[model samples]
Target: MTVSFRDSIALHANALSLREKRNEILASNIANAATPNFQARDFDFEAELARASGPAASQGSGVDATLGYRVPVNRSLDGNTVELSVEQMEFSENTLRYQTSLAFINRRISGLMTAIKGE
Candidate 1:
């Protein structure tokens, strides 16, 4: 039987893509932290993953409809909502998760290769 890698690997693939997009959003928040009236934006990773696993998986970037503006704990006089510490923590957490997903994908690929080699 011919096994389709897409079926087995699509979730991790989509997760990596979503994580990359999230990284970009988080970076943007950090970059604009000092700008007046700037708002921090983010998305629900779990929601995006669900969309990616659905029939309409190829619609667009998973974040399109899920993008949300963060509510700041402390509002600034300049109206900027990007909190440096919060953004940094989020970015770090996302990065760690991205690395974990990457490792999982790598392990999956290694197992597939071994199976193909009949070893």
Candidate 2:
């Protein structure tokens, strides 16, 4: 039986990619916090994961149609939607999740190597 690592590790791999993209988006939001009329953008992680593990798997890219603008809780007079507190929180959370996914993939790879070694 042919064992495809892609199939076995798709979830964690895609999740890591998605989390990286999210981190970029959140960082961009923070960078643009002072730019007038700049709308904060983000993507739905669950939806992107679904798409990444679905028909879009062949595309080999993490991005999809899930990106959207964040609604401001308190609209700024400058029309910027990026909230520093919220962006920082999301960035930190995403970083943690990314590290978790990376660790999981590493463990999985190690287990596979052990199995192949028959030790």
Candidate 3:
């Protein structure tokens, strides 16, 4: 029997990358909340993750192509689509998810180490 280390953690690793990318997008939106005509951008997490994990996926790239402008609940007079409250919420959520993925990867690696050492 053969075990593939990369395959085991690839999902979580891809998720981590996508989450980090998401954080950047949300942070950028928050940073430009006051700028005129700055459209808020985001990617569909589930969709992006699927593409990233697929065989056809280009490693470490494709987030940019998946990015889409977020539609605001209420239009701003200055034409800015970034809603501070929404951006903040999304950022916080993404951060938590990122931490969770990191934790999972850590735990997996720890288990692998234990196995390797036969301890």
Candidate 4:
């Protein structure tokens, strides 16, 4: 079976995009932690990722609402919605995931080279 570079790259590209967005959202939440009445928001990451990857996931998902949905977190009496600890935790987790994905792709490339060299 011929594996096209386009298809292979799509997987990594989409993952990278998701990581980038996650970082942005986390940063935004941290930035607004002290803002009164600011409600913490989070995108439907899994849904967005599925949509970007292919139509199969989109159709199987059966509804588009989840893909782009951003919901507000329950608010405190002070109206500050940013939870610093949670944001930091999520950010660290995402960074690890991103690094893992990159490593996997690199290993794939290395395997391809080994095959080409008949080693």
Best by lDDT: 3
lDDT of 3: 0.90
Q: Which candidate is the best by TM-score?
A: 3
Q: Which rank order by TM-score, best down to worst?
A: 3, 2, 1, 4
The sequence of per-residue lDDT tens digits that candidate 2 reaches over residues 35-79 is 999999998898878888887477466555478999989979999
All candidates: CA RMSD (Å) = 2.2, 1.7, 1.7, 4.8
lDDT of 1 by residue, 22-99 (tens): 999999999999999999999999998888777886744453437999999997999999999999999999999999
**lDDT (Cα atoms) of all candidates against the true structure:** 0.89, 0.89, 0.90, 0.70
Give the C-alpha miss distance for residue 11 in model 1, angstroms.
0.6
Clashes of 4: 0
Q: In lDDT terms, how accurate is model 4?
A: 0.70
CA shift at 18, candidate 2, in angstroms?
A: 0.8
Q: Report the C-alpha displacement of residue 50, candidate 2, in angstroms.
A: 0.9
lDDT of 4 at 9: 63
Candidate 2, run of 10 with poorest lDDT: 56-65
Could you give the candidate ranking by lDDT, starting with the highest?
A: 3, 1, 2, 4
Q: Quote the lDDT for 4 in model 4.
A: 72
Give residue 28's error in model 3 in angstroms.
0.3
